[model samples]
Target: MRDYDEITAFLGEWGPYQKSVFFFLSLSVFPNGFCGLSIVFVGDIPEHRCFIPGNLNLSEAWMNRTIPLEQDKDKLQYSKCRRYRLDVIKNLSEIFPDPDSVNISEVGQEPCLDGWVYSKEQYISTIVSEWDLVCNNEWKGPFAMSIFFIGVLTGSFISGQLSDRFGRKLILYGTMGVQSVFSVLQIFSPNWELFCLLNFFVGLGQISNYVAAFVLGSELLGKSTRAIFGILGVCISFAIGYMTLPFVAYFIRNWRILLFTLSLSGLIYIPMWWFVPESPRWLLVKGKAKEAEAIFRHIAKKNGVTPPEVFFTDLELEDLKAKSKQSSTIIDLFKSPNIRAITIVNFLLWMIITSIYNGLSLNTSNLHGDDYLNCFFAGAIEVPAYIASWIFIQRFPRRLSLTGILFLGGVVFFFIQLIPSNLSIIATVLVMIGKFAVSCALAMVYVYTVELYPTIVRNMGIGTSTMASRLGSIISPYIFYLGIYYEFLPFILIGCVLILAASLVLLLPETINIPLPEMIDQMQKFKFISRRDHMNLDPLYTHAATEEDNTVTQKTEEI
Candidate 1:
């Protein structure tokens, strides 16, 4: 029985067919990048103060007195949510020779009954300004972001099943349309409730489209190119989209216009339906041998190669059919002791990585700099991180690299707290460095987790782990809320969680250059040394009896 890789060998790896598929599939990831994080700009809270009614009737001194003064850090500013009683202030101004002589501190204050006056220096309009999502209603901002992640969680859980039942291409295009339409609808939302409701569906479609395209690209591309496209291509595309976001947000400024622009960008992908092909592997698994053969022939012709009349034999088809029938469930992930340990560790690592990644991203406004520059810096940092990840995954042990980067990120976060409040620039730089480390770990874990699970349950394992990550994202927005109690509490919590996750990573086996397992029994028998022990071993005996025994056992189980 021949494998798909053997068949793909004849079609060529870096030819026009593979390149086109790679380009289109990766293009889909761009819009997902910004749409997911657009809330950072759309919900931004600008400098504001209470609007004093009938202020024109008063003199300059009395007008200033209408709003009480408060100390923020070293600077004094007008109170944001409250103003003194206008009638009392007017009466005092008339009775007293000088308005400044009256003690403003003794005056009573009330909530801004006439609405708030927002600063237009940065944003012309935002959801925060549009709906007055400030002061007592500040919690709504993070809650809207949380609602979107809840949709992402829903989408991640359902996308795989839908792709399996339907096809990758169908689900990919369908979800893309769903994401696009609902995102546009967000601009028309009259209230915050409706906006959040639309955002929920947008999240559902966003992640579904992303995962479908990712899986489709992996299946369609040749083995030699698969790892590159899977690991680096999609990620770099996402970074480009993310970097583009700040520039767009900076220029547009209005929340509705920004969303409309981002949502409309999805239309560019509509033409992809004509260009992108369904996964040939999925077709073959579903017994559509002729369809799969047609796609292979199309790929060959595009690459200027000719295929024999009998490209695939009946015996090979039967073998593939039998292989596809051997399915696994979520329960299989924890049915065995070794596999269970791997599952639990990967789940927790994903949670921590996701929390730190998003927690730092959503908290960009907290940094002392332009929100656009900070966000751009955050996205730009990931580009090099992805490149570094590609090199590290090939050279270093996956387990140690994952643990080391995560630990480094945590240590950076710990030091961020020690920076003086006045040195916000230094703090911002430290946060970006920490973001870089976390980004590297995030890229490594995706490839590492796939390599860790057996082929039988690879999709299930990744799906389950992705769900865990979404759960972490849901909590991420709330993590910043901790600042209400203690200014540095969010960083301290993330740092502690990341460090604890890094320690757990040490328990998992490394997968660098190791043959991927095909079954539970194979995974159970696999053995690995700690990176320190492996480094100490003699190169001549690196593949000695103990290692050979495990390799032989894996092969025997496959047979």
Candidate 2:
């Protein structure tokens, strides 16, 4: 087998033990994965809050607005859409400014309320009429989630660029500082619009920590260790998000306090900035000769190895750049089809995985499973999924494993629909398995995605894939909110969507034995396969290579 690229030379220089600590330190980013789940876990949520208009008396308003929205045809549908938005925006009240809170009209578009955020939910557009939120008529929860992920989607890509252009350390520290400010606003927010606005900034600011932490972990471990380490890092984040969230929700019951406290705690991780090394690859990518040199020396010092100063010179970086050893951009992904295909498939998988993970996990509390044991049961499922991935990911083909798990997830969900409501425990267990499979699929996607494309655009591939996942995460809230009333339909549809996603995978290429190509040029040899076996790429290459050798032997015999 070919050795890992010398570009990964930083690993040999750092050795094994230091690798462990760096990997451990990287765990600090666990919070980023949990942030959305954290902010949404308010007690006031699930049980939608009654944010009655001050002008309308509570009992009278319930008679005119609440009951009417439920029973009347045209009015009920409009009111349900109105309530869903209000439900989401009011949840944003955790961060919105008081007195200045966004009124109903502002949520949809008109901004009837002076400070209200105009809601723009799209996923639940079909059944938004059934639910009820005591907030204004304009609140659009899915749209609100879209706004938050707008921050995440835009922020994640931007931070990735800035990290490559500047340095991961500086970007990480800067984002943490800004995020701290935004989190504080959760306490003071009087209006829903401002809350959405603040979440945008927070999403933008917090993603750097995620980018830098993963980069740091990959740099610390050897290439062989990369998959397991990265997957575990992801599992750690989800498990923590699942486990700790209920406590935070139970204690802080008030989403605002929970948000403020968590945001403020982010600053505590900032000091680790002193110990976290700048990424040697990033430094090499940017041509920062001296900075790269110093960081390399520190890593060598930690590993008890001698530093090579000769490689840190200006001429060396420029040479590395010429040799095609530097990093690249997202636009580079579309420069070739191999990267493009993997990227498209990976993006779709991410979208489905994130939506399923968020849709199921975030709302587990809503399933009448909110007690101590039930909550424990919920948090406990993610770990095994991680264990299962570690076993099957390498042993089985990506096509088989991915499709099987997702298809099974959907099937399980479908079965849950068949079980009666009285079978709560059995149904919850089955749904937990579904959630577990979805989370595992998400983690595996992270590992599989990295190797599917060429190196020039690896980060771009992952970033774009993540951008799609954020789209899924954004879409999930509406899916769950809409399904609350049409309970079986949502579960059944989520299953069907996941099944559709699994089918998409069946149509893509499998990367198991096909060595990860370092550039688009290497893909030329593998492109002529029949479409039926598109994903059956590994064996085709071996067979073709043997046939070529035999042809060469025939010419020799003729001569």
Candidate 3:
């Protein structure tokens, strides 16, 4: 029986048909980039102070003096949550006949009873300013972001199963609609509670849409183009979308308007439904050989080639169906000692990479620099990181590259606290450097995990790793919250975790220029074979192992 790769080879690699699918599918990933990180601007906390009631008859000096002064490190600023007793100040001014003579420091203070006044210089409005989510309510800002990630966590688990049961195209369009609709509704949210509830559903659709596009592109594109399009193409598109957020937010300062604009961007993808097609490989596995053959002919016509009279024979279709019918459970992942160890290590590495990557992205606001520029730099840095990751994977050992990047990121985080407060620019640069390293590590671990797992349980392994990554994302926002108690606590914790994760990576075997394992038993026997030895292996023996492995790997890619 002929394989799908052979069929794709006949269709043509990187031809007009494949290029069109790759372009449109990459476009679908744009919205996810902004939607995931919109909270950095929407939940921003601007400079603010307690509002002084206008009814009190007082000079400008007394009015300004009503709010007590406090020291944030070396800089002195007005207290955000507290103010001096206005009535006591009024009486004291009358008795002393001078405002300056009465020491404001000795007077008692109280929380803002008349509400707070937010600064409009940086942001005209934000979720924090509009809802007074500062002071005791500050935790809610990160909580909302965490809620969004919780939805992503839930979506990651079920999207694969749904796409398998239905079809990739249907799920892609359906989830895109769901995500776009819920994101628009977020603008009309009456309160934070309602906004979080809607945000959860939006999260569910967000990752689901991304996964569908990713899998569909993998199945439709040719092998020569699949690695580039699946790994770098979608990521570069996402980075472009992410880089647009700071510029968009800079012009549209109002949080509601910014969200409305970001959410409306999803509408641009609505036209893609007509241009994209379902995976022909999936159709053949579902026993619809006729439908698969029709797509093949359409692709051949688009590529200006003629299709064979009998493209997919009945026996080949039956074999594809039989392979698809084979079932594997989660328990299978833990049945073997070597596979189990690899699974545990990969999960930990994913969790660490995700936590640091997202934690740095979300914490861009805390860095000592312009928030918009910091955010833009954060997004912009990843473009090169992705490119560098592609190069590193091609030229270096997977384990060494992964470990080196993680260690580099961890060291930067550890020393970030040592920078002098007066040199804020130096500190910001360090944070950006750390962002760059973690971004590369993030990209590397994804491909590395796929190479490590056997084809039989590849999808299961990646799915479980993604779930752990989402769990890390859920904890990331809260990591920034730790800064409130201790200025350097978050950095210290992230640094320690990353370094430990890097050390654990040394335990996994290298998989550079090696034939991917087809079974858990093969994976157990896998070792660090050099390129010279790998080349000397018998051609027939290597071909037999690789043939089955490639088929299973291709199917795994579609998930």
Candidate 4:
């Protein structure tokens, strides 16, 4: 029986239908880039000090001096959390008409009971300022971010199963609705607690829709298109979305308005349900051969080509049905030694990549520069990283590309610590470079992990890997907090982690110029199969769209 690609060759690789699917799907991912990392601005904590109420009847200079100056690193700055005893200050103001005459240093300090005053120079309003998530409650800001990621974790865990059970299009649009509706609800959030709760659903919808789009695109597009869609198309669209955050956040300084604006973008994708069809590959795997063939015929019609009346051979349809009935679960990922090794390595790599990526992205506020510009630079850097990743995946082996970029990222991170503290620009450049490399590695890891799993459990494997990454994201805010102990601690920690992750990449087998495995055993067999042997034994091995694909139309079916 002919393979799916062989049977579907009449539709053409870059047909009119494929182009539309690619365009719509890539556009759909644009929101994910910004929505995933909006916390940079949404949860921004600007320069703040105790709010000295006007009822205290204090002079301007004494009022300004109400908050005690505390030693921060090498310089003295106004304390963010503490202020001099208000009653004592009021009494002192009566005794010493001249504020300079009093011993301000001797005054005792207390927490800001009246609440805190946040600077509006950067943000007109953020969750931090709106909720007074400063001082003792400052941890709440990070906790809010973590709650969103926890929602991502939940989404990642269940999205695959949901997608597999329901059709991809159903889950894709359903989660898109989930993301859009909940995000709008957050605009009416009366308290931080409610906002965090709504944010969980936002995160749930966010990653679920993203993963759905990813899987749907992978299944809908042809072999070559899959790689490009996964690497350049989806990733670059996300990066573009990410870059928009700084621009939008720069204009709308209020977090609520910014979120409302970003959340509404998901609604634009509602029309995609009519344009994008269910994944034919998924339908075939689910034993809906007739439904899959109807989609193929529709694509052919759109592309102005006539498909064969008999789209799939009876034997091919039977093969699909047999495979469909053989269900695989998460337990199967660990049932075999080789598959288990792949699963474990994937989990660790995804965790490290996600934690480090999120750590670097989230810490932009701490970098020595303007937060908006820093964020813009952070998002802008991803474009080239993704472009470079596309080129690497096209030219180099998966393992080499992932390991090389990760090593380069790790080394650059280490150099960041060695830079002079005075050269903030140099340090910032290094951080961007580190972001570039890690961002590239992230793209590579996504493609690599996809290729590592067989079709039977591909969604499960990707979902579990994504779940592991959320664990990393859950702790990433704390990783950035490590900077409080030492300025370079986050970078130092990321560097060490990336170096180790790079070393681990060597253990996994490469998947370049190889057909996607159809079963878990086929993936495990990769370790023992030489490249030349792969081509000789499996005619479909050159599924990367080589010239051989034109002539090798039919081959013996085996796994």
TM-score for each prediction? 0.92, 0.75, 0.93, 0.91
Output the lDDT of residue 345, model 1.
82
Model 2: lDDT of residue 412: 89
Sequence-dependent TM-score of model 3: 0.93
Candidate 1 per-residue C-alpha lDDT over 152-178 given as tens digits, one digit per residue, 9 for 90 to 100? 999999999999989999999999999
What's the residue-level lDDT of 383 in candidate 2?
A: 77
Ranking by lDDT: 1, 4, 3, 2
Candidate 4 per-residue lDDT, tens place, 1-559, comes to: 6777888888999998899999999998998887778888889898899999998889998888898888887789999999999999999999998889988989888899999888988788988999999878988988998999999999998898899888899999999899889989998999999999998999999999998998899888898788889878898899899888888888898888998998878877978888999998888878888898899989999999988878777777788787677665788777666677778889999999998888888888888888889988999999999889988988998888899999999999889888886888999999999999999999989889888887767877888899999999888888877777897888898899999999989888878766767655456333444433333223212235446532332221221
**Cα lDDT computed for each candidate against the true fold:** 0.85, 0.61, 0.84, 0.85
lDDT tens per residue, model 2, 289-405: 577667667767777777554654456556756644444666665544444565676788898888888777656655645553455556678778887887778798777798888
Provide the lDDT at 174 for model 1: 95
Relative to the true structure, candidate 1 has a C-alpha RMSD (angstroms) of: 5.3
Q: Write the per-residue lDDT of candidate 3 for residues 287-360, one digit (tens) a residue.
A: 88888888898998999988889876777766888888876777766765567678888889888899888889
Question: How many clashes show up per model?
Answer: 0, 23, 0, 0
TM-score winner between candidates 1 and 2: 1
